[model samples]
Target: MIRHLVLFKLNEGVAKDDQRALAGAEAFAELGSLIPELREWECGWNTTERDIAYDYAINSLVEDRESLQAYLTHPAHQAAAGQWREFATWVIADIEV
Candidate 1:
C-alpha cells in the first residue's frame, strides 16, 4: 500500500474566499469518487492563522506505485490539474506509508 499526500499553497492572485476557490476545492475533493485507482481521497481548506505555507492537503491511498502513477495521470485528475496550475503557488509532498 502507498499513501500519496500532497499539500497545496495557492497563488497570491487567487482569492481563498471566492467562488473559484470553492469550486476548485469541490472538484478536487470529488476526484477520488471519479477515479477507481484512488482507494481514498480527502482534502480541505486550511483554517489557521499560523502562517502555514500550504492552503490544503490531499491524502490518497493506492494499491501500489502503478496505481499511484495511474492516479497521477488519470484524465479526471487532468481536469483538476488545469485548475491547480492556475491557482496554486506550489505543492509540497511526502508520499509514503
Candidate 2:
C-alpha cells in the first residue's frame, strides 16, 4: 500500500475563508468519492496553533505506486490543485506501507 500525504501552507495574507480557498478545499473534500484509486482519504484544516503547523493537510491511502500515480494525475485532482496553487504552497510525501 501507499500512504500519500500533503501539507499545505497558505501564502502570506491568504485566509481559509476566501472564496477561492473555500472552493479549492471543497474540491479536495470531494475527491475521495470522485477518484477510484484512493483506498482512503482524509483532509482538513489544522486545529492547533503551533508555528510550525501547516494550514491544511491531506492523508490518503492507495493500493500501490501505480494507484497513487493515478490519483495524482486525475483531472479533478489537477483542477483542485490548480485552485490551491493560487493561494498556497505545499509539500508531499508518498510512503510505501
Candidate 3:
C-alpha cells in the first residue's frame, strides 16, 4: 500500500472559513466516494495555533503506485485539487506501507 500525505498552507489573509476554502474542503471530503482507486481519504483544516503547523492536510491510502497514479489523475480529483491551487501551496509525501 502507499500512504499519500499532503500538507497545505493557505496564502496570507485567507481564513479557513472562506468560501473558497470551504468549497475545497467539501470537494476533498467527497473524494473517497468519487475515486475508486482510493483505499482511504481523509482531509481537514489544522486545529492548532502553532506556527509550524500546516493549515490543512490530506491523509490517504492506495493499493500501490499504479493505484496512486490513477487517483492522482482522476478528473474528480483534479477538479477538487484545483480549488486549493488558487489559495494555497502544499507539500506531499508518499511512502510504501
Candidate 4:
C-alpha cells in the first residue's frame, strides 16, 4: 500500500479564515469521494496554534504506485490543487506501508 501525505501552509497575507482558503480546504476534503483511486482519504484544517504547524493536511492511502499516480493525475485532484495553489504552499510525502 502507499500512504500519501500532504502538509499545506497558507501563503503570507492569507488568513486561515479567508474564504478562498476555506473553499480550497473544502475542495481537498471532498477529493476522497471524487477520486476513484483513493482507497482511503482523510484531510482537514489544523486546530492547533503552533508556529511550526501547517494550516492543513491530507492523509490518503492507495493500492500501489500506479493508483497513487492515477490519484495525482486525476482531473478532480488537479482542480482542487489549482484552488490551493492560489493561497497556499504544500509539501508531500509518499510512503510504502
Q: Which window of 10 residues has the lowest lDDT sum in candidate 1? A: 87-96
Q: Write the per-residue lDDT of candidate 2 for residues 25-91, one digit (tens) a residue.
A: 9999999999999999999999988889999999999998889889989999999999999999999
For each of the candidates, give the backbone clash count. 0, 0, 0, 0
- Kindly provide the TM-score of model 1 when superposed on the true structure, using C-alpha atoms: 0.87
* Candidate 1 residue spans exceeding 4 A from truth: none
lDDT of 4 at 12: 97
Please give, for residues 43-78, the per-residue lDDT of candidate 1 as tens digits: 887777567557877888998888988988988888
lDDT of 4 by residue, 23-82 (tens): 898888889999989999999989999999999999999999999989999998999999
Between which residue pairs do clashes occur in model 4? none
lDDT values for all models = 0.80, 0.94, 0.94, 0.94
Alpha-carbon error at 14 in model 1, in Å? 1.9
The parts of candidate 3 lying over 4 Å away from their true place are none
